[model samples]
Target: MRFSRAIATAVATAALAGSAAVCVPASAATPSTVAINAGGSAISASGTSYSADKGNIGGRTSTTTVASGTTDSALYQSVRYGMSGYSIPVTNGTYDVTLKMVENYWSAAGKRVFDVSAEGSAALSDLDPFQIAGGKNKAAQRTFTTTVKDGKLDLAFKADQDNASIAAILITPKTTATPAPAPAPAVGINAGGSAISASGTSYSADKGNIGGRTSTTTVASGTTDSALYQSVRYGMSGYSIPVTNGTYDVTLKMVENYWSAAGKRVFDVSAEGSAALSDLDPFQIAGGKNKAAQRTFTTTVKDGKLDLAFKADQDNASIAAILI
Candidate 1:
């Protein structure tokens, strides 16, 4: 995919502000690293050099003492508040992104609720630094892996309650691996995004006439197939797949990446015009947000087509991947 022209325009603007928005090539042999202090000046700590405030929008700096448990307190001491987000330039590749944060203003949870998106896809939803770090001045960090086909990684922060803020940013390149072949007698589909190969199984990119929307948010735990669960199709009515007339076991992978509570999302699944799973709550089954859960059922396809229907009881229906 070609780089977004809007990103190129932003990078040109960052150039006038003395920001590090240069497009640098990154490879496996010598991968490039990026570190930036959100609202502070340039500094070097722990043998890593951090750039000064750059590539940000509509924010100011605030200095405060950071609590223990982290050696790099300077990184978390100065934060940029009231900013929309950041757009940093880099070569097209996959990178591991880490955001350093602290709740210096609010003491209790729910005071600051926001979401983090990378490349226009959800990376984190409803994040609270105070609750995650156990205190106001404590450090809280969130990390995720995302691919960047464009020449830049655009991050957006939308606050639900309070103003959005961040202390520092770290972006490191990752080595790409060879893709594996798909297994026979099994059809795997990454429900709402690009194709992915994981756990010796190759899943193709999402393709079907399903009536719904798609999302790309990373899941926290409970499975090694994070790529499979990171993307999903939500608010769908049903999907139909052509198959041989035989009995087959179908697995529907799911995760609740939006809501934290259990009763937020509930749905039912039916296969071949019969009940397969009744009232499936992903958050309740997985115990929390950003966790993986699944449901499997056996059905006989007599009409040479496997029909799967989903009906929502709560928010909406969501599915990450499908296997048959």
Candidate 2:
């Protein structure tokens, strides 16, 4: 997603030193629904127009593409780092606050530590975006429901070490209706390997006319099923699981057993010919090789079958197991 790193760093250093002033809104937007691209210019994402970096803070930009969860990589390419907090003017009422964070700078855990407080109470503590996200250039978010009494919705970033940072902030009025929980899937696959049981789920061994090569290796962490993760199918094209017409949650059980670093093994996942995951880095999302990482997506089976496709961006695409 690499830009002119040297130049961007120099420019950010200067602005971070206090050259950038707090920007006031132009009265063209609503205060209840607010989206801010923390350290970057104004951009639109998912039909929402996020304002330019506002409040009293500093920001830096990166060229790396944000992995998974969001299609708008630009929203997370820049970050408002080393900030004490932000004071955003908002309508007084109950609101859902969502903070979009990405570790574009640090790679290892504990390198950056911070806590965030909404209004005056703590909302997120001991936050390590890199650790929480598993790797850099990955998306991580925290949402909290809060009531804003004052004219402004105050946020404080208490830096425990290096500096506190944020990529974007979104505020929206809470809805009255609470959506029902997602229903679990009834299908599971071992993906090019033999079927085995783990974590109370019975995964069928390489189901749904699998077309890939299978291998075995040890998985480090993130699941109780080491056997499930140990067996993997690489260079697989896709899978077509037969099921009754209905919507279900599909979870891809994955681990990076070959590639040791991010970007080495990157790919995209498709469900029913629609993009499910883009630029999915197993090594990055799972934190490291042999570590368990899984992504759950909801899709509907219309043709009495669930069609899934995998396209590789870097090396060969792979997966350990599948839960449909």
Clashing pairs in 1: none
Could you tell me the TM-score of candidate 2? Answer: 0.60
Candidate 1, residue 153: lDDT: 83
What's the TM-score of each model vs. the native?
Answer: 0.47, 0.60
lDDT of 1 by residue, 217-269 (tens): 65455677787889999998898888778888798888998998977998989
Candidate with the greatest lDDT versus the true structure: 1
lDDT tens digits, residue span 1-324, model 2 = 046887888889978765444354334334469888888889999999999988744434444555544688878888888778888888777789998888888877667789989889988887778766656777877788888877688888888868888888999988657976666457889876787888888899897644778778654455667788888888878888888788987888888888778889988899999988766777776668888877777788889999999999998888988888
> Whole-model lDDT for model 1 versus the true structure?
0.81
Model 2 ranges with Cα > 4 A deviation:
1-31, 40-78, 84-95, 101-162, 178-206, 222-227, 243-250, 259-266, 278-281, 295-301, 312-315
